[model samples]
Target: MVKLDNVDRGILHELQLDARNRTAQEIADKVDVSASTVRNRIAELEGDGVIEGYHPKIDYEKADLPLQIMFVCTAPPTERSEMVDQILDIRGVVDVRETLTGRRNLYVEAVGTSTTDTVRISDSMHAMGLSIESSEILRQRQVQPFNHFFFTDPYADGDDNGED
Candidate 1:
């Protein structure tokens, strides 16, 4: 495990907030460090695989592919990990998750333009020998950065004396 100092945590928090638009200098300002330090720390984090990759928060509905479905299935405990790559290969499959539990151990999320697309995904999974327990249409998903790395607003302070 990589040891992260307060500055590293601060940098990670700021980056999680808006990695694409927030520059190193902006993170440095919030972390009370120099831009160079922020950049170097980010490099170290990436090399250590702590920061895997940046992903956009896409709105599939706005993109005109509104059908988002989650498939909960049960696979042989020993085969779940091996199935990840194959399941991902299925068109429209966006995410696959393996759980420690025995029943309903495999979860797959997929996007589609129509009901036929969803049916095709189900047929593919069935062909792969997966028992689909349930398929639900996902309404929404929300995400937030880990709160352990949370920081107070840079402009907010202990001295809260009637200020907007």
Candidate 2:
């Protein structure tokens, strides 16, 4: 595991808020370090795979992709891989996760311009011999980093609480 000093943690916290606005010099100023030090630390973090590539959070509505849906799919044991592959081929699919549920073990997140497009993608999944047990539109107002929030000291060796 990568070891993050306080400065590194501060840099990450700042970047998470506004990835595009800060430069190494600015980050150094905030963390009270040299610009080169900040740059080197960031590079080291990136090299260690602790810091992934930066990304722009695009507003889907502005991008003409407003509708969002989640699909819970179930497939025959033998056709699971094929069904997953077919679902990934759908145009609007953004994410797919293999869940642990008997009725529907696959969760798919997709975005499209309209409900019709979302339905078309669902229909295509049906045509691929995949059974969609349940589907729903996801209205996400706020998203938070639950893992980070809950597990602040991820490397702690002892039991998190005495309750366990």
Q: Where does model 2 exceed 4 Å of error?
A: 74-88, 98-104, 127-130, 145-164
**What are the per-residue Cα lDDT tens digits for candidate 1 across 90-110?**
999999999999989999999
* Best TM-score among the predictions, by candidate number: 1
How many pairs of residues collide in each model? 0, 0
The TM-scores, one per candidate, come to: 0.90, 0.68
Prediction 2 global C-alpha lDDT: 0.74
Q: Please list the C-alpha lDDT of all candidates, in the order they appear.
A: 0.87, 0.74
Residue by residue across 1-164, what tens digits does model 2's lDDT show?
Answer: 97777777767765665658878887777667898998898888889998888876656777888887899888776667666777888999977887656568788888998878988999988888778888888776365332242236432445432111
Alpha carbon lDDT of residue 89, candidate 2? 84
**Which parts of model 1 have CA positions greater than 4 angstroms off?**
150-164
